[model samples]
Target: MVNRVEVFAAIRRDARVEGMSIRALAEKHGVHRRTVRQALEGAEPPPRKTPVRMSPRLAPFKSAIDEMLTCDLDAPRKQRHTARRVHVRLIEEHAATNLSYSTVRDYVRVRRAQIDLAAGRRNEVMVPQEHAPAAEAEVDFGEVYVILAGVKTKCRMFTFRLSYSGKAIHRVYATEGQEAFLEGHIDAFNEIGGIPTRHIRYDNLTSAVSKVVVARGHDPARDRVENSRWLLFRSHYGFDAFYCQPGIAGAHEKGGVEGEVGRFRRTHLVPMPVVDSLDELNEKIREWDLADERRRINDRIRTVADDFAQERQLLAPVPVEGFEPGLILTPRVDRSSLITVRMARYSVPARFIHRRVRVSLRASEVVVFDPDKSGRTQIARHPRVVTKGGQCVDLDHYLEVLKGKPGALPGSTALAQARASGVFTAAHEAFWANARRRLGDADGTRELIDVLLLHRHLPAAAVEAGLTAAISVGATSADVVALEARLHLAKTDAIAVVEHAGAVGGAGSGRHLVAQRHLDEQQDVARDVVAEARRRKVVSLTERLLLDPAAVIAGLPPDTRPLPSVEKYDQLLRLRTGTDNHPAPPTEQARPARPALSVEETP
Candidate 1:
């Protein structure tokens, strides 16, 4: 409660003005003769010297603890010992029963610092820095936690901050992989409308640096063997990369972004965002970035946006053509019709099994492309799984395979996912149940699979509507489902066609009469009692069942012919001009002579 400096002043004043003896001053001020002598010598008291007290209990274990601490210098920084660990070890190993933990902790703290100092390690020395407009920027990834879909998930926050303006762009990703890294840069560049003219500072992230060539007396610039993809990306964007020295030495190289990451996290991401998906989290981050532009960092006179405005014009314009940030991969599909990408599995079409397919692994999605003479065509796309061993499967991808092994359909992971995602709707469940009950499981599931295959061509809504129509009519056949789905599609097409005809008819030209006649025909069909309810502007079919189900069902005649077989038509695909199997019809002149001779012989 008392100030030591004030006490010393009082003692010195009393000694001088009262002319008190050392004993008298000691009695009056509650001070010792040594303290009185110190006060008399100078107004400011000399610091008290710490006593070299002996620790009798701790003496026996000192060597062991010292050896442990000394050896920790060679161990990993994360694995090094703390005061509590040393105390525990002493209690467990040395059996120093009477020793207090505080005693060991105090000694360990002082001794560790001394040991580090002795080993030529000291606190880092930091100096002030100045940044020029549009000159430099820093890139870094910081860990962030979010409650995604009611589950606690760890995510990475990519921050790109301009040194001069303190203006930053932030995006959250599922992983800190090269795809996310490159995408973060692309997003920052596009958002800022330009790139930093000078080199950008970066830590030696594995995404950019494949190998760090650490050699004595070598330039840090050439020390890194940049990743080929990263080099190509940087070259496309027209920017230079300045890699920091590895480890602690490089931490301070990008201090601006390092501090920015923490500042943004503490200020905006404090509550640990609750989001349904990563895109939702990033949407929040984008809003925060915009709000931060109006803020002032530390004690600056101008806001971040104000400073950025002046710096914006100085920055180099973004390149006209942008670069693809997704990492390209080629993975062979297994028997399960799944391809493994970055330890995660995603389903492609069953036709691609045992075949290598090109994948563009982006931050949020994986795109599979099938390359042919016609060039690459995207066959499947799924959300990228964040965790290792995770899978993203589409039930439609394995329809053909499931058709052969209908027993596997009920227990398949893809089917489970489809049910979870509402892709397999109640109508589908109802239809499958009916089919299984009527046709038995094996044949019934095959029918369901056939109906499922229609989803590849028809809209899911149409297929779901078709299922409902079939269930209402007590139709267990996949053909009925296909026919209803096709009818639903026809209705949609008719509506579009009618609208287009109406627009064309407004031209009031003679040629418009054709469209008008088609429109009139469609109207006449709608007015007909048989098709009246089928041609209305309807809501989503998945949300509503068809009107007049009994009437439509009764109007449907029993189909004896197999459902629209195209198997025979496939032969026409291999059209041969002149082959023994199917020679083209002989010309009349060419066949006439042979025909005349054959007829005379027959007569």
Candidate 2:
């Protein structure tokens, strides 16, 4: 700016004092024609003018805008008005028709700082503290956006992060409820192998806090109290709770987990993770947790997993079996053998219809229980589904209904769901088709029902294998399929028992191998109960034969070879000497009694 001013002044002096023409000055001073004419005509480039303009349209609304901005100083930061919001208020409240958004924006931008200054604006300060090893942790919930089944969806993620090691656990949930909250903590404890000995910090989440009183002082204990269920959950796990203030103002209190949620979602869920089910998504979450073992913090010298290794040694061990955070609902099964939950249908057993049954709804599974004359039995369990109006059906649940209406079996929702889940295999379809051709529709459907009932007693894989074998051999009867199924179960079960026993001890003993052969010979419970007795009898008889081999040989038929007669020769010498033939036999030590064998026979 100074150089430009000096050059303009020099051009004017040369043009005026040297008596140079305007055209000559333009060429001599390297100035534009108009610049030389203006310089020659003006006095030292008349001081730059300051212009002032007035907007009559916005004059009436200025006071109202100032009032709104002043009121915003006392309101929550997030609730503060933007320039556009102020413009909208001006039009709606003040009837200011001619005011544009830009006019309000310019004024608000210029005057808002004065409003904040009058309200004493200050930046929040945070104190940094060193985290003790295995002494504390932070817990919080955050929203996570994911691509589920090609559809973009949002879910809540419960994050638990250790303060010392920066280790974290992330779990995605369809809903953020008390059960999911408690379950996340329990799972984190179980994963890390121990509970933090000191306090666990939490945001003032409704899941943990029932109310937050404003009268109490800085002590969180007096200001906020835990909900009844939350207190019970904390007591069961044997941990202390630390509550942050009830809003975004105290977010820094548990910022470790708050930041963890964002960090993990950005690192693992970027480029959008597409998964078919929540379980598959959680499996990927576990993989991310394992992968974090190799990651180091920004200024750390070692991996987070290594830091956790040190903190883990100081952690308090949790009990082997502990609390189960799940909701116990008593929802009656409808006529369709399905129960409505969260606006979706989940199948239970047909026998439970119209009857109130106990349903244990956990984070992942919906387990149903039915009461009978004997006791309560777990009838069925299905993965909890979140899709609205979606149905989760089991073929076994409708097998009894299918038997009465074979035509319905062909087009039942249960069968379709089973096929989609891959529980109803191609082998089942093949067997059903073949049976239909051989025995007609009704009888074939009944046969399929019988095969389905076998699943209650035998493993599904065994039953499927049996169906494949039966179809291959051209055996169409349900009895043939059942027999093959039982044979497979017996064979596989025997092998399992042998392998389990060998694993319990050493494999070189060969005792398990011998027992496996004996087990394969019979599958009846009564035979198994007497198998040990039979083994003892054979051993006892062999011992007696060895004790009196000469006498047993003398009693044998002539075709068999006889033992040596050493005892007879000793008897002949006694007879010649005429000594007491009944003299006491030379005393000898009795063989040590063998230890009793232990057997746990199946009833």
Candidate 3:
């Protein structure tokens, strides 16, 4: 059962050590005399020759098959004949009815390559690469599935990996379009704190490639037409893009990232990630990226982080001005207070209904802008709706209109969505119910709407706390709720200010005492201000004018008339009081009287 090499070794050892004759070796090893002689001549056995089988049935068609293969040389790579096609053609054209398909297929396979070789067409070869630190990087999108909001959803993982360090930044996006593509680069650049100096390797993704302009015979990368937005993005970041050739031929060009995407997916995203949103999934990916810094790739000597530290400094500094990676659209707000972006509807302020609003559709969110004399102002922001016909509504946007139609508040879609999202909390519901019981449905709903409006000027937590406080005190008035919210906000601000002052005022030595004293004085001033604000009466415009007419007039223009004085009437008051013996004499006599005309005389 010994192998040939072992047999040869044994034969050589026995022949040399025992000095046995050829006939004796033959007798001992059970081989013929000539075989023994050959073994004695050389310890190593000669390689066994492979017999070339002559196919009688296929020999007649060999010339035809060669001609077909030769003609295939000029044909498009994909349009060339397969082994099966060659077999079929031989039977059909030459009437080689008895030819086995396997014989014709095998002959065609070897003969085709021989023809191609003679014609100077060769298979592609991959060269091993040694990457320089911070010189180059690769970007790619890997498809992954995640349980998003309890639904199995497909997402794209955008990966940007440094060639040398293998430090990667990953982001999950709902779409792999141009906006997400650009945004991925921005996020990676910001995370790495710089850009790769040479170029980033990428496949001709549609996001970056307008078209592959080359014919099949030409080099795809050289003849590609770059996308305008992609060109602008590359110019802004000051990096070059080295697109891989189209299809499988180009896949090996960015092998680093191609392998990296699979590796990361297997390592981190193996168990399909469960997340409420893409943002959450991306957050987890970022954490995984940080953890990956300690890992080594292949036979690397240092950790990913160690190599990245050295490479980081060599990278080009990122530009100061940030790029907006969102797609801008001007959508007319529909009558339902919604604006449609990419087939999904998102609610804007009710006032924006029937008006054209500018929307910035980003990877994770939709932001609507309202333009005025003061410039563009952000009116609403909602998490992007991924599916068509989906809607994202904000209760606050409809609160103003709902105030007028209080009954609608009970069954409005916006309110339901608000409740589902925990924006309308238990405290809010409690306050609303209490208000309804105390004030009846219409007035109570109006009060709830007013409380909701408080969110515009106050923090949500403060407003919620205010609602809870008001409910505890059996107060259904929106004013009382607003007052309570302000109180909560003031408390929070005071605590924050005091903590900030303490932080700014350092510790150690007599200087600390001085800082503490200054802080105390600041606290005293703040308390006095708060007390003054609390004690001051809240008044309407009319009451303020009656109480302090001078103050109001002082704010008026210089050309404005002065307010009339009541001092002239004080003389009459003095006579009535008997404090002054002023003349009450010039009554009707002193006053000039006008003559009366009788219109009835003419009639």
C-alpha root-mean-square deviation, each candidate: 10.4, 15.6, 8.9
The best candidate by TM-score is: 3
Residue 51, candidate 1: alpha-carbon lDDT: 94
Q: 1 or 2, which is superior by TM-score? A: 2
lDDT of model 1 at residue 413? 99
Q: lDDT tens digits, residues 117-184, model 3? A: 77777655668999999999999999999999999999898999999999999999998988889989
Over the stretch 246-337, how does candidate 2's per-residue lDDT look in tens digits? Answer: 66767888888888888987888887778977779989899899899899888889999999999999999897667868777887788888
Compute each candidate's TM-score over C-alphas: 0.67, 0.68, 0.80
Q: What order do candidates take by TM-score, descending?
A: 3, 2, 1
